[model samples]
Target chain A: MATLMDRVITSKAAVLEGSRAIAEAVRLCRPQVISAYPITPQTHVVEALAQMVADGALKAEFVNVESEHSAASVVLGASATGARVYTASSSQGIALMSEVLFNIAGLRLPVVLTCANRALSSPLNIWNDQQDSLSVRDAGWVQLYVEDNQEAVDTHLQAYAIAEDRRVLLPTMVCADGFLLTHTYEPVIVPTQEEVDAFLPPYRPQHYLTPDKPLTMGAFADPEYYMESRYLLDRALERSQAVIEDAAQRFNRAFGRHYGGLLDTLHMEGARTAVVAMGSVVATLRDVVSGLRDDGHAVGLVKVRSFRPFPKDALRSALRDVDRVLVLERALSPGGVGILAAEVRAVLQGQPRQPAVSAFVAGLGGRDIPVETLQALIARAQDEAVEQGFADLKAELVEEGDEDES
Target chain B: MKTRVEPAPELLSPGHTACRGCGLLVAARLALQAAGPRVIVANATGCLEITTSKFPQSSWNVPWIHSLFENTAAVASGVEAALKALGRQAEARVIAQAGDGGTADIGLQSLSGMLERGHDVLYICYDNEAYMNTGIQRSSLTPLGARTSTTPPGALSWGEVRTKKDMPAIAAAHGIPYVATASIAYPPDLVKKVKRALGIRGPKYLQVHSSCPLGWGHDSSLSIRVARLAVQTGLYPLYEVINGQLTNVKRLSYRSPVAAYLKPQRRFEHLFKPGGEALLAQVQALANANAAKYGFPPVTEGAEAEDSD
Candidate 1:
């Protein structure tokens, strides 16, 4: 046991739910603290982790906190003391954890939270959506959205590596769509302890609170020094792109799983129309675009994985060949256009040649969007591309009197 | 066994910007000094954090962190959990310190969560009553008939009409291993409680009745004197509950009249006026009830009101 702390277990491809795969990835990381509250979609991930600890498969302190706020705080405190920690939450749970999320990132603690993406409440719904995490895009956390269970598992391993990287030192949120990915069972590779040990080394906290070496963290900053601290944090996050990319590269080389940098692409070369989306929707778009290609339509798919850093240059380069870009967003900014579409447009700005971006908002509050809907969005983008497009809005759900006619 | 002042160097050194004679820092000094250098303080955003650690300079000689106003207890829980995870629980101690507002009100949920989780953390609430860091706003711990910026005296209302929330009792209700109340006027006892709480392996609570000269409307030099009166009047009892049992009590010699304690602070100055007499009587009734609850053996009555300053 002393000769490396842990001997690697050879990874096995087994059918597992996305939540269980995330839990398995966390077990490999050897988190010292696991504090989480039960929220739909997110509940399974933490429950599986708790069972692992209970079964002695994972040796860690599993603290079942009362609420998301305390769960976040428990990890924040533990991380400050140089402990590798993990927590899971979603939707209202994530919203409740928002304050601590900012604190964790601000303190530059390398904590990781598995966010099983769910929609926010009232009229209270518990289904999958990206709005929960997307709403906190500016909270200074490294947000990595994945395509499927395999990618979700892979990203969880990478999240720990990148977050604990000395250059990055930022909290990471591994986002996998609720119900769609979290509940759906799929084949996943569980890396051996030896392989994980070789890929991601033991967490050596860059900064920590220790009694022997006394230092003050989270000190009060007056007008003179406040902005500089935030400026430094911003710079650190800005530099994390290289660290994230490097970690992904090293993981691919070691484990035979490739996550192409901050953003991934498919057939953007010589294409006139590209469908852009994040999380599981990106996978759906990929298959839909592939079928459309055989039908003589010039189409491609842009899979946005890193939503926090926004991957501006990667996104700009990927969409350069496309003429009409259909941005499929599962979340709407309410009174504004599509969340992902707005971001894609903003990042694509000032590039020499940019595509005409069309925004489509659907799949909200776990509403199903079938293949026909994707085909409809493609046709709309190819013909009359426009921003702020609503797909499958269920027009009859709204009474004619719901809107006041002038 | 009585706790004597042990030989030790100053932990909370001079040059701090705390209002001169403010007992909050004195309580902090005694507690930190007692814990020695083997402790890390997870402080909430209040007087202690705001006064010390202004960027490049820090008065702390021990590892300390200030995460947020309401989450210090939870932060300390994390620290303690981490130490345990690293097989270093015995190498260091974790303490969460916050002001009254952070303890009894806005921060209560986090503090309660920490205690319930049974984290090996020593949580100290420096009770200076109202939100002193935010200019003496009303807090749940603020005593009845005390003036504050939010609960100011008026023609229709007496300041802070609700009785003070029993924070130590609330902590004891968590069924933690240790819960205690101490006061800055008695440094030896407060320091002893801090030491005793640290010796325990599970969650511990030490609510020190720290005094704020600015917020309490008292002369800065009389901070300790006022703290002593609070205990003497039975408004703030010095006692300890170990393993869900009241194990120790620093019995008062004689129940001091509440008026003697109230008259010195401007926050209670309204009671000195004609219309404030009835409110003062109610405050006195509260002290009497507290005395009966603790049931301390009464001794000498009316001691001389010595003006130490």
Candidate 2:
């Protein structure tokens, strides 16, 4: 006689790296279909899963697609028929699948994908950065960032919940830092398959291609109806934010893990200086905050989990008490400050006693950002806040010479 | 074998707003018949999209979606893929329909991706020679010596200096399972080709010669007449490429001269003027070369099948 936990067990607790954690989480989800093509950083995630499927650990259809476009197409087909689907890609792979990515969103299929954040190539560097994920910010998928291996596992479980929620039938992206989280192994508390089973119910597609009940998933919207269709999509996305938060709360109640809804704050109590960041950089910020606190400085950290919903009110409330807010952005918007900084500034507009916000663009093109550098960034932002009082808020780029200045 | 075949009345109706004698409307009707009731169409931004689906009202009787200008094939592939994944392959047939500009020029890359992926989809290009919805712009499928908004006759050059794109040849090169060319002039033949394309397992391409009366500067009644002449003159030969091989050629026993095809339309009026005869003769020679290449066999003495009305 097997126990309830054994009946629900999808994966075992093992010392797995972040990338392998992603592979294992997806395996436990038991995706009926996987379509992937190899690209730097993202290759290992699929490769590990391919080996699992080959070894019969995961019983799923693995499609070795020719291009990123075909890979997206394969998953779109598999998912359209009401099957659980999964895919992984990075940088160039994301760009190649850009067209189909938009289509998958428009068709409203709950396709789960992991983006090992990497730099876009022209000169072709396969290192860590958020350029790929940030490039697809408006792609209409529920985007989430994981700071460590545990979050990677936890979020994959919640992604199915958020994406498959009847009210929010949208695709979800689980993004992690390339090489930083993907290659770095750590101790993660894997939820017993039973816990996951209770957390994530079987996906019952609201609309799918079926002969018994015929419904059109994708229909032509001419100009007259096009704007209205887009309006509906916007409304759906706005509704998804609440759905994600509710799903997170439910997940916490079920697993006893306080997976914060949309966004998470650490050590923001009575702090005058705050640093806003996402992905694996939050771990470095946590270390920096502890070091700063030991030296009698009031510094804190805020980890942005759901970048798509933007969590404007929550972010504003978190930074209200702080006199200085330092934003560490992993990608640049070419002619302006980082995209995140622009979005955060937009949210801070017309708010009472808004903190002196400074934008620091770092970790671009897979450049390494050490904990010492992040500490310097926080210190410089606080100093600038006291001296210049938001005058240097839009600091464009922290160049090599400025490293010593900070 | 002159069997009477009646057009299905349910697929498309007469009260639609398509221009009178519009060949694309005829093509759409035949295509819908072949696709039957369980069909979903992904239409591109073109004349058909604008005229049929103008927001407040839609002329489409079946499920239809209008994606972007160049992504009809990609969208249809998505729909078909989803349907197949859901184990409802026979629930509906996905059809991607676009104009010449959308298919041959702008949407070519996405179309190629869909075909290369071998999606269970049928892509139909209603070749009306120019971008009619955008007002007579020259498209890749526009024939040589045809005057268009972009390719107007001038002192230095004639209209449309380049030859019409060999679309069927290019599609066949993709190694798709089925590829064919048809015209609205031959409704039964076009319908049969559509049915054949749908019956194929993988990606299929069908290019239909749809005439534009307003854009071509011809009498509205001359649309079908001009399309028939195009096929008879070997200017737009009807043929099928099965499994990458040019299997069947829709040959005309006695070919007509290119002048008969060009004289009715104002777009090709320049080809019959002063020194244009020489250019017209060159056009005729090109048609003759095509006939020779496709091996159009001569008709026997008394063995001829009568055209069914």
RMSD to native for every prediction?
4.5, 5.3
Q: Which stretches of candidate 1 lie over 4 Å from their true place?
A: A1-12, A400-406, B1-4, B296-309
**Model 1 CAPRI quality:** high
Interface RMSD of each: 0.8, 4.4
| Candidate 2 stretches greater than 4 Å from native | A1-12, A30-37, A48-84, A96-109, A121-123, A187-197, A208-228, A386-405, B7-9, B12-17, B297-309
- Reference-based TM-score of each model: 0.95, 0.87
The digit string of per-residue lDDT tens for model 1 on B1-309 reads 555688787767778788998888999989999999888889999999888878888888889999888988888888888888889887788899999999999899999988998888999999999999889999999999999999998988889999989898899999999999988988888877888899988899999999899999999989989999888887888889999898677776567778889989999999999888899889888878877888854423564264221
Model 2, residue B265: C-alpha shift (Å): 2.3
DockQ in order = 0.82, 0.28
User: Tens digits of per-residue lDDT for model 2 on B231-251?
Assistant: 877788888999988877886
Q: Which number leads on lDDT?
A: 1
* Model 1 pairs in collision: A8-A193, A8-A194, A9-A192, A9-A193
